[model samples]
Target: MQQTCVIGAALASCLAAGTALAQDDATLAAVEARGVLACGVNAGLAGFATVDSNGVWSGFEVEFCRALAAAILGDPALVDFHALPADGRYRELVSDDVDVIARGGAWSIGPDVRRGLDLAAVSYFDQTGFLLPVELGVSSPKELDGARICLVDDMATGPALDDYFHAAGIAWQPVAATGDSEARSLYLAGDCDAYARPAAELSAVRATFETPLAHVIVSDGSSRVPSGPVVREGDDSWANVVRWTFNALLAGEELGITSANVREMAATPSSNPEVNRLLGTEGEIGAMLGLPQDWAVDALAAGGNYGEIFERNIGENTPIGLARGLNALWAKGGLQYAAPFR
Candidate 1:
């Protein structure tokens, strides 16, 4: 009787462990079954994520979602975008309303650890900076003491701005704007002395102005915020997909692969081992992630390489005109470096 009881107990324990393992990948299974990758994006952040009058979504972050869908579903168009407001975006993810949040938000220790969220990667390195009229003749933030600043209320930029001023023993007043458009309007109307926001965003805002050269970005590296996509904690499979999809984008850029040439490059495998592995010519990276061997190819086809996406969306020729400062490849003294595929 005792031997029979021990065997039954061991069997039950094994079954419980198997159940836990299955639960770990529940999110991935659901995504596959749905056949559509639902991505949570910003309601309207010009260069990051925004919809046009025709309801077509196109932006830097939107491209990431399309790439994810292409890698997983083999079709970039098989994606459902949920426009989320800043305050409730995380909540929507936690409640399983969205599979992933690709809206670029600053990654901080507090949100990652306390909010039960995982920041997939630092897709964009943003510096907290101030934008004011070039006529102010202020080349530095320190010169803006007692300045009234227009800031977005929902982001961490407002607090970071306060920290900078308080630490410098300077006094300033903050005029909180509900969103980027409002902040820009407030600043342009002379309601605020300076507009405080991420440098990339400020650049985008400046470009929209009637006179682009009328404003200057004053940044001394007081605060550097690395922003990226977010996924629910405890789902390793889903997290890995999002992380590697971003890496593949970076690798494509590093290997000189672009949307226009990805198919040709994949057809004729490269002698470079890294390129071959990334393009699925040499190894089984895609299978390891439960995807096709040409997953990276599909992703790149959807959005082109990281550099290509940047140049197409927010680069020098675009209204944003943002140079690839820290976003440049690591070989060019930038922070974007992809891990080895092999």
Candidate 2:
């Protein structure tokens, strides 16, 4: 009887181990078999994720997805973009409807600790602020006490707004909208006194207005908004691929590897050990991640470096025209610093 019990216990333990191993590599195996990276993006937020007149998607987040595809599939075009509503992003990831969420979603304690999701990395550092029509002549968010504010219904901003108002001992009404477009519409139509969103997105929203100069982003009541890609929990391999892809973007910028110069640098190895390892000249870092040695090269080729992606999408020349306040490289006095490639 004792021998039979031991055998049965061993069998059950082995089965449990096998199940855990399968769960770990499930996402990566599915992505490989599908031959495409499934990326979730915002429906239509200019400068972050938007479709052009020709139905081509292009933006900072879009470029990240393309880079990820390039790294994994060796082709930047092998990406299936899903336009997801803000509230449904987490559900989509959990349900396996999308592999990764690259929308500009703020990382908060609820999603990270409570929900079975992981915010991989901070792609863009932003702050939450209020946008008001200049006609109101409101210089500060505090001046709008008891006012109606347009906010996204399902986001960290909802709770953040509530906390801010409660702490300030102010009364306000929330005019919830399904998405940024709806929020902007309500704000523009005078349904709300102000529109609350990330300052970067507020600029994008304002650009769509007929008279962009008529609106102003309030400088008060701001909170840190660190947005990034999100993936389902318990898949460290898949998460690493997404996280390191973002790091490669930042590392490429720091190493001065641009789309225009990556080919040349790859062909001719440099004396810099970090640059060589990053470009697949020295180490097997890519192989460690189950990718080709030239994975970073493909990523950089897809969207240029991180800096180039920003400059092309939302830099001073673009309508959004955001300066690299906290998004710049750490060496250049910004917060964007990547882990060592080694």
Weakest 10 consecutive residues of candidate 2 by summed lDDT: 1-10
Give the Cα error of residue 279 in candidate 1, in Å: 1.9
Tens-place lDDT per residue, model 1, 1-342, is 133323687888877766777866887788899999989987776677888889899989899999999999899998899998754468789899999999556777767888889998888998888999999999999998999998888678777887888899999999998777788889999999999878887887787789989889999987988888899888888889999999999999988999999999999988899899988998889988888889899999998999988998888888888889899999999999998898
**Clashing residue pairs found in predicted model 1:** none
Each prediction's TM-score versus the true structure: 0.90, 0.94
Model 1 clash tally, residue pairs: 0
lDDT of 1: 0.87
Q: How much is the lDDT of residue 160 in candidate 1? A: 86
- Looking at model 1, residue 17 earns an lDDT score of 67
Question: Candidate 1: deviation at residue 20, Å?
Answer: 4.7
* TM-score of structure candidate 2: 0.94
Query: Candidate 1 — which residues are off by over 4 angstroms?
Result: 1-20
